[model samples]
Target chain A: MSFIEKLKNAWVSNNSLLCIGLDPDTEKFPDLFKTMAKPEAVFAFNKAIIDATHDLVCAYKPQIAYFSAEAAETSLEQTIAYIKTQYPHIPVILDAKRGDIGSTAQKYAAEAFERYQADAVTVNPYLGLDSITPFTAYRERGTILLCRTSNSGAADLQDLSVDGIPLYQKVAITARDHWNSHNNCLLVVGATWPEQMAAIRQLVGDMPFLVPGVGAQGGDVNAMVKAGKTADGNGLIISSSRAVLYASNGDDFAQAARAVALSLRQQINVARA
Target chain B: MSFIEKLKNAWVSNNSLLCIGLDPDTEKFPDLFKTMAKPEAVFAFNKAIIDATHDLVCAYKPQIAYFSAEAAETSLEQTIAYIKTQYPHIPVILDAKRGDIGSTAQKYAAEAFERYQADAVTVNPYLGLDSITPFTAYRERGTILLCRTSNSGAADLQDLSVDGIPLYQKVAITARDHWNSHNNCLLVVGATWPEQMAAIRQLVGDMPFLVPGVGAQGGDVNAMVKAGKTADGNGLIISSSRAVLYASNGDDFAQAARAVALSLRQQINVARA
Candidate 1:
């Protein structure tokens, strides 16, 4: 199925647009798992989180760095396997933000799609068409290009005006005009900037946005949904990382996460309506 | 030793400012190695090339995409190991251009520095200060920020203006003022645009530059040195990939690569003088 259709199906079936970000900061993980002496503890913790919130979210974004940083390749492979087998329907967006020259990008595309088997992946578009083409080449997967980010320093370069348009606007247009020819492109607009989100929504039309910065980052979900949602009310995938994943660092962590995910989903639905 | 001091020593010791780019295109490998297997062949070729050119250039820049695209983690690891072990004095710049959030970036920093053991790595500063801080946090390694790239589409954003300052100039100044507080930052200016290089040089003062766009990309090295070199003539690490590594596709490929590296180094020395 196409990425959009799959996303819509997942959203409707799960009755949620919230994407649980599995950043898995080792320092933030429960002490029990930290002292487990093996990487399996990390995967076991992730499994519990997925089990608790799988029904409450449309997608799961596993930030690749967390896994790769631990030098836990096996854990990464197993976690991906579990997500694909156990969740089945929930799309996985590997938050890799990878970009390189054409030939190199092909390898990354293969790694994310073929090896990890993610439904979508985040990409950096600074290298231009060649860097983005390899990811978009995979017709079945979604490619989320970084546009206006939520970080305090985003204005350092993204706010500059190219020709007559801000750099982010130009990125949106290029993503819309050139890269999305395959209809698999998405824009990553931080929920922190609703005005930019609204403007980019106008430039990008009906394309889906993987919007981060909603919860712990203090982005207003209602404002973001108002600015980011498609006319059909299916364009936004609002993600919350620490606020949802670590709602409680104690034993009720999984339940706390589920509550957070459920509340965000309901909030998104209300805002969409 | 500080990254800048190491670079200075390499420059004087090698008597060459040229940085040999290790962008090993699988298709461009000599026919002899093609039959050896996928990544093994790639590594074998890289080892041979590095062995031949180690003394000819001051630094070796491995464009991460080429090795990464092949799903060849072993080869990538081996290639980096080979460079670090064989040429301890020469710096290795992993051209990954990675940038992300704070937590994620910490992992990337570990991957590039702790795992690959590169002397420096290229970064995309689109996400702002938090994205770049993790890399610069490692005070011992150099973090080269993408100021102006060598691609045709660079103008899509890099040339944009903000508050009367060109985007690239703003990025250069930002890197100099904000990110350089650790004193471990560098800028990436494409050798393709000499005028921009000159303008950025004036903006950034004396920080070292990892220039790529010589050779196959058609960047003018002489013009680039004229515009990009520091007043003391110690701030450029001009890189040529396709023109050097793929100089010939025969058994003597390594020798051909060494010859090109020598010539480029000679050219850079003469231009600076």
Candidate 2:
């Protein structure tokens, strides 16, 4: 099945649209795991989180940097393998906002989709269409391009006006026009920007969106659902990281995470209906 | 010493400002290596090329995609390790062209700099200061921001004017202002556009540049040097991939590659003088 179809099926089967982000902040982990080992501790923590929340989430978005920071290629490989083996239905969106020239982007596409085995991957579209074309070449996989981001500094470029239209709007339209040629394109609109989300949805029609910035980043889930959801209510992949995964520091961390995921999922379902 | 100092020293020591790109295109390899094995043949070819051209060039940029297209993290790790062990003095720039929001970008910074042990990395500045900040945080490492590129379609967005200044110039100015705080930022200006290179240099001052498009991309090295050279004649690192590494298809490919590197280096030196 296509990545989008698989993702929708996963959302329906799991009864959740919550994408648990595996940031794996070293300082947040308990002191016990800190001293255990380098990449082992990271993998163990990730595996436990995945096992606990597998049934509650439609997808798992592993922020590549956390594993990369440790220079732990082994842990990264093992994490992907574990996800593919344990939760075959769950989509994995490798949150790597990579964008480069054509020839170079081909390698990044291979690294994220082929090596990591991610069902979907995040990309930066600043270099224009050619930079993003390589990722969409994997027609079966999903390519999530950054549009209106949730950060405070997003206005620096994304909010700039280009010929009376905001740059984000242009990016959304251009991505829809150019990237759709490959038939696997999605936009990343931060949950924090509900108004922009509504506007972008109006412009791009039914393209799937990877809506980040919900949990610890203080984005309102209700507003995001209301503004960002497609006409069919299947286009939004609401992602939360710290609020769900690191909900509690105690031994019941996994259970606490599941509880948060369930609540978010239920909330999304109600909003959709 | 800082990365910039190290780069300057390498340029002087090698007597060649040329930065040979080790992009091992599988199709360009000799017929003998094609029958040998999968990644092993690629690795063998890369090792041979690096051994021959190590002294002829100041830096080696391995376009991560060539090895990454194999979809194997082991190959990526092995390739980086080989460069570090075999050519220790020649700085290795992993041309990943990664950029994202501040929080996410911190992880990429750790990945490219800490994981791959790359001396320098290429980044996209479309996300503004947040995207580029994380890389500059590594005060010791060099961060090359994308300016005007050598590609045909780069003009789509990069040529668009933002309040009288072209997008690439604005990127350069912003990178110069924000990246100066860390003091380890450079620009990626294609050798194909010498006029843009001259204009960008005026905006960013004496910062070093990684100039691509010199080989098969039809960029004139002499024009690039004349336009891109700093007052001290140490600002440009002219890079050529296909022309140098694939100069021959026979067993003597390494020697043939070395001769090309030497020629490019000589041209750069004479042009600068």
Candidate 3:
């Protein structure tokens, strides 16, 4: 099935918009991981989290740098495989924000889709269309572009007026019109900027958004749901990482994570109603 | 030594500004590599290219996508180690245009600097200051930001008017003024756009540029040298990948790669003169 179909299926079947970001830091691992190898610990933690919260989320996102930093690419592979094998319905978005020229972009596409078997990958728009064409070429995969990021410094360049439109809005409009021929394109509109997200939703229509910066980043969940959700309340893939993943540094971390995921999902639904 | 110091040392010692990009594609690998495993083939190819042309270049850029796509991170690690150990003065630029939120950016920084030990890494400037602070925090490393890319689609957003100045120029100005507190920032001004390169040179004032698109991509060597070179004629790292690495698919591959590297280096020097 195509990425969009799978995403819609996940949203309906799970009845949730929450996406759990599996950004593991070995330094924060529980005592269970201290005795095990780095890769083993990461996979174990991810497996436990997935087991605990698989029914609560619409998707799973694994930030690539966390795995690559620890030289735990194998663990990342295991984590994705475990998710695919076990859940089968929850799409995986590899949050890689990769961008380069065409030839190099092809290799990155291969890395995300072929090497890791992710259903979607986030890409940077700074290099423009050709850098993105390679990822969007995978008609079955989703290409998520960074629009307005959650960081405070996101305003530095994203807010620069481009012929009166903010650069991020231009990015949203460009991706929606010119870059979405395959209908596999999406924008990453930060939940931290609710007004911008609302404006982008109006500009991009029903194109789904992978919304980050809600839970641990202190973004207002109510504002994000009101601003970012589609008419059917299905467009936002609200992501929360550190808050959900490291809720507790104990053996009951997975249960704690589940509690956090359930609460966030309920919060999003409340705002939706 | 700092990345800039090492880069300058290499330019003086080798009398070349050329940076050979190690972007291996298995389908294009020579017959000898067909017998070896993918990682082994990649590392062997890189080692041969580095051995054959190390004296003729200022830096070795291993595009991370090539390695990650093939699950050959080990090969990339080996290649960088080989250069750092044998050709200590020659910097290695990992052409990974990575950008993310501050927390995730810290992990990406570790992946590039600690895991791979690259002297520098390419980054996308779209995320603004906080996304870049983690990278620039490493005072000795070079953080090369994309300005005007070599691809045709580069003009998609880069040429947009931002307060009357083009967006790429704003990026150049911002990097020069705000992001270079450590003096470790550089711009990637493509050789395909020489006039823009010259304009950025005027804006950024002697800050180095990692120039791609010269050989196979049809960028003008002479135009780039005249446009991008610093006051000391030492600012550009002219990188050519396919034209050098895939010069032959036969037994004399390394020698052919060296010949291409030598010719490109000479071409750059002639332009400098």
Best by DockQ: 3
True contacts kept of 3: 0.86
Sequence-dependent TM-score of model 3:
0.99
Better of 1 and 2 by DockQ: 2
Task: Give the DockQ ranking, best first.
Answer: 3, 2, 1
List the pairs of residues colliding in candidate 2: A107-B65
For model 2 chain B, the run of ten residues with the poorest summed lDDT = B68-77
How much does each candidate deviate from the true structure in C-alpha RMSD?
A: 2.4, 2.6, 0.8
Interface RMSD for each of the candidates: 2.2, 1.9, 0.6
Higher-ranked by DockQ: 1 or 3: 3
Error of 3 at B146 (Å): 0.9
Interface RMSD of candidate 1? 2.2
lDDT of 1 by residue, A1-273 (tens): 867788999989988889988877767877668777456777887888999998888888888877766666567678878988987888889898887656567877877888778889999988788778888888999999999988887876788777778889989998888878899999899999899999999998898999988899999989889999888888888889999878888888899988988899999999999
**Candidate 3 local lDDT, B1-273, one digit each (tens):** 999999999999999999999988888989989999999999999999999998999999999999999999999999999999998989999999999989999999999999999999999989999999999999999999988898978988999999999999999999988989999999998989889999999998889999989788989899889988988888999999999999999999999999999899888999998
lDDT by residue (B1-273, candidate 1, tens digit) is 866778889998988788888877788888998778888988898899889988878788887766655656678789888877878888889988888977679999988888788889999988889899999989989999998888776765677667787778888888888888889999999998899999999988889898988998888878999999898887999998889889899888889988988888888888999
Tens digits of per-residue lDDT, candidate 2, A88-190, equal 8888898888777788888788888878888888988877778888899899999999998888768877787777777788889988887679779999999
Tell me the DockQ of each model, to 2 decimals. 0.50, 0.54, 0.90
Model 1, global lDDT: 0.85
Per-model TM-score versus the true fold: 0.92, 0.92, 0.99
Best by the TM-score measure:
3
Name the runs in model 3 displaced over 4 angstroms.
Answer: none
Flag clash pairs in model 1: A107-B69
